[model samples]
Target: MNYMDMYKRWLNFDEDTKNELLNLDEKEIKERFYKELEFGTGGLRGIIGAGTNRMNVYTVRKVTQGLANYIKNKGIENASVAIAYDSRKFSDRFAKEAALVLNANGIKTYMYKELRPTPMLSFAVRYLKTTAGIVITASHNPKEYNGYKVYWSDGGQITEEHAEGILKEISKVDYDDILTMDFEKAVDLGLFNYIDDEVETAYINLVKGLTVNKDIVEKAKNDLKIIYTPLHGTGNKPVRRVLEEIGYKNVYIVKEQENPDPNFSTVKYPNPEEHEVFKRAIEMAKELEADLIIGTDPDCDRVGVVVKNKEGEYIVLTGNQTGALLTHYILENLKTTGRMPKNPVVIKTIVTTEMARRIAKSYEVEVIDVLTGFKYIGEKIKEFEEKQSKDFVFGFEESYGYLSGTFVRDKDGVIASMLICEMAAFYKLKGMTLYEGLISLYEKYGYFKEDLKSITLEGIEGSQRIKEIMDMLRNNPPKEIAEIKVREVKDYLKGINDLPKSNVIQLVLDDDSIITARPSGTEPKIKFYFAARGKSYKDTEERLEKIKMEFLRLTI
Candidate 1:
């Protein structure tokens, strides 16, 4: 049936809900019921609205019921699930509704009483040995959006086979047939458990283990001036607590964004990648003359940093730059102190800069590239644990997500926050700013600048358009983006570089520039990842701009 038919069916409900659906405009209804919510590599994310397809209490219940059914079918009789939510609107309610749905299915449920980071949810799944986990977050989406990410016992997002099983279960359920029981009754029956301080303590202890130089932190504790913002999400308490516990003094929280506000009142977009989101924090940093400014996304899974340059202007560091600096800092510190792991391995996404790989190679640390999401990195970590061949040193993506320790399976902003503060502190003790440190890194390992351009495709046709673009690129691969020759191509979907077929095409230029074009699995957009390197910052900047302009011309 069409959206109109679905709208009519929805109107048959009780007065309030019927009115709510009726009040929505035609465009709203079309967008909501255009199609079923897809389970991408990142899980379900949609605009929160009233429909069988949107993210509402009913949809959340239906998805949870399907998950519960899938878990039961796997012969997990005494299965348990951990649940957590961020500061997004309806996140808490959606989490509780999901827990209750699982509870009604005779599964044990452990949910956080309040908002928490996405990584902590992953950690709780492994630490508590739960059968599965659910996190209510949309990552860095707008305020009107929300999401549900399902994770397996290994703490990574559900794999393809498991997700297919859950999808089948979801298909079997009728929207009106989703069963939900009373939350109070679920508690009384011993099926629902609200996690408390003990879990927090365990998580905090795990974070404390991520610290490398306690003595360095001790020496620079009082000298560091750091400003942090949670972006009105879930990082406030845990980030501050960890910093204080690590012996950092004068760490200032962005007062306006300290509390949890579902609307994220302080910023237009809650994403840390966007410089506008850090306007308030940056202002505060300038006033306080702080050494650095750090901000985390809604679920506290990604982090962004800003440090003062030599001209006294704060410059926002890209994810690639941040990862390189942090990785270099950690490994160099470890090596200097004679603590560097013998079999260290660093992980990054396929689209991340090759500069990171070169830097790791210089340190004799192996760099492994995975698909976009952090789960692939987590899977690699699991593989390393099983094979006992390599030690996981660090994992990062070009989108500002990084993980220092294996305590969390996903990208962790809290850990990133702690480490960033420590890095700033370490640099301050050496009488340098974070920006200077980054410059020095570039001078040592050739200057590298990466630019990412995303073309948003919305509604039903948007997905098809993105796929069509990918198909076009695959069919008629670009020989040269500008005047430079395309040397080789690496396709990730085909799981090979030049040896096999893949959806991704990386064009290598004569000047050593690389251009990668791929459709974003999580969002309805096609992203162009550009990486250019040179001997100096000026040379790198000029080449980067030239490459960017050439890419735009070719794509257009």
Candidate 2:
């Protein structure tokens, strides 16, 4: 249907929605009602307000009704789902809204008593043996946005096959036909339940068990001063509990951001990958002369780490650097401790640092590259278990996501935080810092660095422009970038490397630098990822800036 038809259909829903729609100008109306909110593999995400193209009570319920239909169509017995939410605006309401819709459809639902992390939702699905799971989170996006994530019975986000099925069901759902029941009534009918402390303990125990070396954390717990910030989101309780249970003595929470604040008042984006988000944590680290600083995004699926450099100044570590550190630590420690498993494997996205591959190779472990998404990594873990072909050791992506152990089939900041500090404690016991450990790795292997740049173009026109940029790059591929020769260009749209077809282009440079261009699946943005092998950090930094500058000039 056209925007006008969609607008009229939504006009009489509620007074507040009517007011929101009537107040908008033509341009605002077009932007707000251009199309229904996208429901792809990433699920629904948009600015929160009234409109078919945004996230609101209507859209949330409609999606749930579709999911309920999908579950019922599968002919499963005792159909149930696990539901959780983060601290985003209207998140709790959306969570309950979804549960009530499921309950009305004669399906069982379990929702968290309070806000929880996305990984916990993934875990809860398996822990509760639910048929599916849902999470209301935008995942470090600005406060204006919110999202819905769907997970299948395997405790992983819905893959393409399931997404297509749900999307089909959603296409058949009509807003007027949506159903919901009173929360109290649903509870009385035994169709609705709330999850609390019991599940949290089970998750924490599993996180603690993933530790590579427990003795190091015990020995260095007192001496290792660490500062952590949850950034006003759901990481506060579980992250802190895991650290404490693992015997870390000197861990400090940044007081300013210890509690949940939906607006994320302290930081602009609530994303841990950005250095600016860690301002307060760095200040506290400097004051305490802390050994390390760590922060998790709102949903606690991604994490960031900060450690002192040789100059005595704290700096944020890139996702690549942290992934490599964890890879080396896990493999080397397991080997030395005689705990290395046979046929162990590490997984990474196509755009993640090759340094992980090098480190994994040094230990004779296999490295598998998947498409750029944590769900793909999670899917691989499930595949490994099913085939009994390879042992999944670790998995990471460049966007501040890491995961170990199969307890949760997504990137888990709670466990990532635990293992990062443990790695820091390991280096501290050697009388060295993580920075020094990284430098040693560079010395043994070649010096490698990676950087990213993204240009966000919002609304309809912006999306068209992104497609144009991709087309230009693909039709007339870059022979060289910043004076370096491009050895080859691999267009993923043609289904390269036996992977699923995607709209991505990768340029392999003569200097061993790999530049990848892909549009963000969930947001109105196009991103560029760069990797370079240089003689030193300075060389890589300079060359990276030059390439980024020249490439943007060409693309923009």
Most accurate candidate by lDDT = 2
TM-score of 1: 0.97
Can you write out model 2's per-residue Cα lDDT over 1-556, one digit (the tens) per residue?
8888788777899899998888878888878788889898899999999998899999999999999999999999999999999999999999999999999999999999999999999999999999999999999999999999999999999999899899999989998789999989999999999986789899999999998987887799889998999999999999999988888888899999989998889998999998999999999998999999999999999999999999998889999999999999999999998988888999999999999989998999999999999999999999999999899999999999999999899999998999999999999999899999999898887788989998899999999999999998899987888999989988999998788888999989898889899999899999999888888878888888888788888778
List the lowest-lDDT window of 10 residues for candidate 2. Answer: 2-11
Residue-level lDDT tens digits of model 1 in 1-556:
8978877887876677688888888988887776778875477998887887778887898889899989999998689999999999999999999998998889999999899999999999999999999999999988989999999999988877788899999889887777778988999999999987888889998898888788888898887888999999999999989988887788898889999898889888899999999888878888999899999998999999999999998999999989998898888888888988879999998788787888888889999887777888988899899999899999999999999888789999999988888888888888899999988888888899899999899877887887877776667777876677778766666766332233577777888898888876666788988999897889898888888898778674
In model 1, how large is the Cα lDDT of residue 265? 91
Clash count per candidate: 2, 0
Give the TM-scores of the predictions, in the order they appear.
Answer: 0.97, 0.99
**Reference-based lDDT, residue 287, model 1:** 94
Candidate 1 local accuracy as lDDT?
A: 0.87
Candidate 2 error regions (>4 Å): none
What's the C-alpha lDDT at position 521 in model 2?
A: 87
Error of 1 at 352 (Å): 0.9
